[model samples]
Target: MIFSSQHLLFSSLLLTGTIMSISSTSWFMAWMGLELNLMSFVPLITSKTNQYPSEAALKYFLVQALGSALIILSAPLMMDMDIFSPMLLMALLLKLGAAPFHSWFPSIMEGLNWPQCILLMTIQKIAPIFLISHLVTQTSIPEFVTFSSILSALVGSLGGLNQTSLRKILAFSSINHLSWMLIAMLLSDYSWLIYFFFYSIISASIVIFFNLQQYFFFSQLFSNPLTSFTKSFMSSFALLSLGGLPPFSGFIPKWIIIEAMAYNHMFLPLLVLIFSALITLYYYLRIAVLSLLLMTTKTKLLSPFPAQFFASYLTPSFLFFNMFGLLVPSFFLFF
Candidate 1:
């Protein structure tokens, strides 16, 4: 995890590109930012230690290139022809890995390191989702949007049921959350923003936990000695919160969205999302229960004192901030 100068430079460029893409006023500038982000991430994904990185880099490049091409190809028609709207929207959906377009997501996540996975799931989504949200406001395609959202929710829930890989499970989880975000996009005003903000916090926390444990598989969690009772409890709580179970901070954003959907009278879509969310919670609980039940006392995992200190602080600090909403529910009422 020691960063070379090249890594630092590329990381900076990655952030710059993400910021530029989201802030750009013109399509061409946004496209440039996307390209910059992609190129920078490619170099970062290449590892001297593994071939999976190379294969993942290639697959990521090809899919992203196709999306960028579609966006560029359809940009000219967006102003005049409403027919091209779906094309542009599809391009963004592909970038976001929303199902039935989510085939590449798990494979790609499986290939990358934890840091890369974090960027892939979190920051990398900013440009495409932001653009897609803007387009949803401008164009009138309620049915198509709803269908895509439902399909993503269904795929995300059903797909993760058989996966043993932690990364793949998280990938599907991200897809399911994307469904919530998209629903918030369509019906609620700023609820999507609130949802996405909290989503990132919860995701970053879980990813950090995995990174600290060096866990990539479900079975690995049971074998890791660092997973004490306290650690397991906090970890389970984090996953439940991310699953949007009631009484957790994750539910706050969902609550905002539900209230907004009720106000908008989107009962059917709301029901579908709620059902899919329950399915998603099943897998989260499966993993969480295993964490609590499986305990090994041998200390095989080694960490520097600094890392231990950080992890100790990170677990409680993250849980406290996330559950802060539970203790003071009124703070988020404005959203």
Candidate 2:
């Protein structure tokens, strides 16, 4: 938890597990890698001092174990029987926390610290999603994934509408983004990867900002009078970027995916995705507007502390990227 030796060991194993799963040539090896990944993550999430983490660890273990069991069970049968492909797909979707199977995600996120939450949202998803991409090429899997994507978009957008906890909001946001990535996966091999790369950067930046401020809820953003105008503005901008607002880098990948979807004539899913995106942007705007528009009398220009200093310096780079990063793709395209 403190980046000590034990943490280092487990973290290394965690990465090893993901690499193994993604790179493995056989189902058995992949399953073993997933198990190793699961085992390594449990220790990282568990803590003696905190009860919530322990409870979270248990829930995470159980859910992941069930998914792993399904994977192992279905993997052997997949070659001989077509039905097993859906079973295997379901297992991966469960692991990815794609909706309908996503009930466990928000609760687990609530119990994690920001660092662990970042891992859960980003790195932990890589292997399962890669496996899903592989599986999508099989018969009947696309329809299933399509339905799950639509459901994930709807559930993720609707579920976050009333949440106050920052973690829960992020959890739902991850789910919504997963819907987009799922659609991207069906469209092309690399579109989801592109979307995920941008998503990870934006999500990590937002969470890191929250971690720096020790903010766990919306109320804290408003209550902390020492919050600076620069910090507030950056935070709002990051949230908007995450919500996929135009002119921000976050919207770039979504725009690419939208273009591809249009070319494919997938109008219905496109409409649903766009509408759900609007809902997601609404909540993000809610947070950003309240934090940016409401004036605080005791706002500080800068805080004389090491943490604030680090954050203050780091924020400008992120702000610059969010503001101008949309130009990057075009720069490559035209020139």
Candidate 3:
């Protein structure tokens, strides 16, 4: 995406809205913030050059509007009626695209650009998740959320298995990660925050790499001869990291969550999560192996040029973090 003053304005509003929602003390204020966020993001999704973005914006708007409506309608009744708590939880789950309600997420992502997809997967999630944490703390809804988390893990992992679109794959991956974060939330207060922080970093790196290469589908990795070995390798490594391979930065959060879950005697959900993660890793490894080992040969006339100064520097820096970032958790553990 091209950066414009308009984009800058909406982006700022988006951040402001998220901050407002997360920091709000009352449900009404939080609803206002969510509305601000929804409106700001719709403008960002609609693009002048793309017809699909308009469709995506409409779908996104409808889903979010429904969730917001549910939230507002249930907020007043929440204190008086215990039943409304589940209604509110459902609204937030719909907003978060947690499973059984996650069908719209990949379709919406399919129509978006990389940056918009990144926002959908990461920043757009913060408020709803924060509110869900609040709800979890106040209510006895572990069975409901646990079921959703397990279903989300299964759906997210299975949904991406046959996808060719990179956007959709990442969408499913986000849902899968959402399961883990939900589990983390149940395990401890700050563990989910730690999971989200690392997840955002790894996801951003992978999405940026995809954006730089203008790759939309898996086939592009194998067919695009312009992709150099170094670029391919770096991207593959990043994908592996995002898949939560051991020793990578991405695994640290998972390890922490696993340890926490074990301590809490949450074996069933932990087993399901581990199984789903392995399935998720399969696809990532498939992509990495195809891109790195079976790469297409570069033609002489269509040979790739040397990497740009900025990309050359930036790619390695991202890879460095992904490779050695595990040291952060390790350092704390030992010291």
How many clashing residue pairs, candidate 3?
0
For every model shown, what is its TM-score relative to the native structure?
0.91, 0.94, 0.93
Q: Per-residue lDDT of 206-263 in model 1, one digit per residue for the tens?
A: 9998898888999987876655666677788889999998898899999999999999
| Candidate order by decreasing lDDT | 2, 3, 1
As for lDDT, the candidate ahead, 2 or 3, is 2
Q: Which model scores highest in TM-score?
A: 2
Model 2's C-alpha root-mean-square deviation from the true structure amounts to 2.6
All predictions: root-mean-square deviation over Cα? 3.9, 2.6, 2.9
Error of 2 at 91 (Å): 0.4
Q: Looking at candidate 3, what is the lDDT of residue 293?
A: 76
**Of the candidates numbered 1 and 2, which has the greater TM-score value?**
2
Could you tell which candidate, 2 or 3, scores higher by TM-score? 2
Quote the positional error of residue 59 for candidate 3 in Å.
0.2
